[model samples]
Target: MVCVKNLSFRLQKIILNDITLSIEPKGQIIALLGPNGSGKTTLMNVLADLYQKYEGNVHDVGKVQLLPDYAYIPEDLTIRECFNLFGQVYDTFNIEKAIQIFSYLNLNQDQLISSYSKGMKEQLHLAFLLCHDVDTYLLDEPLAAVDPLTRDILIDLIMKFKTNSGVTIISTHLIQDMDKLFDEVIFMSNGKILLHNSVPQLFEKYPGLSLDDIYKEVNRNVPFN
Candidate 1:
């Protein structure tokens, strides 16, 4: 279980407002639905203790691992070298596991990351992060840089990660395509939670509406300002 209660963050101005959330992981994947600059990154950062000056009580979480908005690997390093470096930093990093993941990408481990394309880098970054065995994964836009075909592959990876008895919160703008895959959906806007509901509950409430339609309806009733 992970809980954030009465959380408010400030950086020049209040970014997270008074937000609260609870997550129960164990083959559970939650969707953090929001648009660009909707406080998704800020909330995840606070949970990761990247920002300490925030007002909040974050509790009951263990082995929290965050995949930040930026890739942490060095551009000049080869894929194998990057894995070795991260393996040294994280005790949970499994070289064997990382190598197995790379088998899918067909990437040359000897080549520098600088030679990879944006989408390739993005996929590699995610693959690297999955090498760590952790309880919580904060994935900001996990599918941001991938093409349609690659997106399916990454989604499969994320699904497999769910069975690891960990909680995964994925922040993404591709809500329509991903909504049905989530156990629950959290609609966030302007630093506030507009709604939180299980996918089934959402369907029950909206009846025949699609996720995009539901989002529109929720936003219409809520004050995004």
Candidate 2:
């Protein structure tokens, strides 16, 4: 499990405000749902330990695993280079899984990521993340810049990861297409959690409402300030 207490961060302005939340261990996927600049990505960065300029604490409470690590794929890395770099760093890279995904995505190992299309780059990033063994996976906008087919593939991998006991956290703005995969959805606005609920409980409280509809409702009724 991961816990954050009294977390407040600022980047030229406040991004997260005294946010305290805990993510359960496994058997679930958590969706950090928010619009652009709503602090979803910022919070993900904090959890990933990509940013230290913040107040409060982030504690990883779990067993004595060999590698209590988190993986974050940068958008700039090449497909081939990222594999080698991460392989050397993590030492637990899933080469077989990587090969399978590469073949499925039709990505050549020699090709530079700079030459690939946006969709292909996204595919490469997802492939890299899947081929790594990590306790927590923090993905930012996993569904963006992809065609429908690639989107489905990404979702499939995420589900597979969750089933295997990996704590997965995804930050995304594409609500309608991605909401069904979330076990729990965290709605954020103006750098704070406006609401959080499990998928079933969400539907229970707001009867007959889709995730997208609930997002709109929350934005309308929940003041950002």
Task: Identify the runs in model 1 with alpha carbons over 4 angstroms from their true place.
Answer: none
Candidate 2 clashes between residue pairs 3 or more apart in a chain or in different chains? none
lDDT of each: 0.82, 0.74
Deviation in Å, model 1, residue 125 alpha carbon: 0.7
**Candidate 2 per-residue lDDT over residues 1-225, each given as its tens digit:** 678899999978999998988877675777888777788877877776778889999899332111112334554666667777777876658676777767766777766667777776666667777676667777777777688887988787667543356577777777888988888888888888888778899899999899899889888966655
Local error of candidate 2 at residue 38 (angstroms): 1.9
Each candidate's clash count? 0, 0
Weakest 10 consecutive residues, lDDT, candidate 1?
157-166
Per-candidate TM-score against the hidden true structure: 0.92, 0.83
Encode model 1's per-residue lDDT on 1-225: one tens digit a residue: 788899998777778989988878776788888767779998888877788888879987677678887878899999988887998898878788888778766779999999988887888878887877778888988887678887887887777544368778889988777776788888998898888888889989999998878877887766555
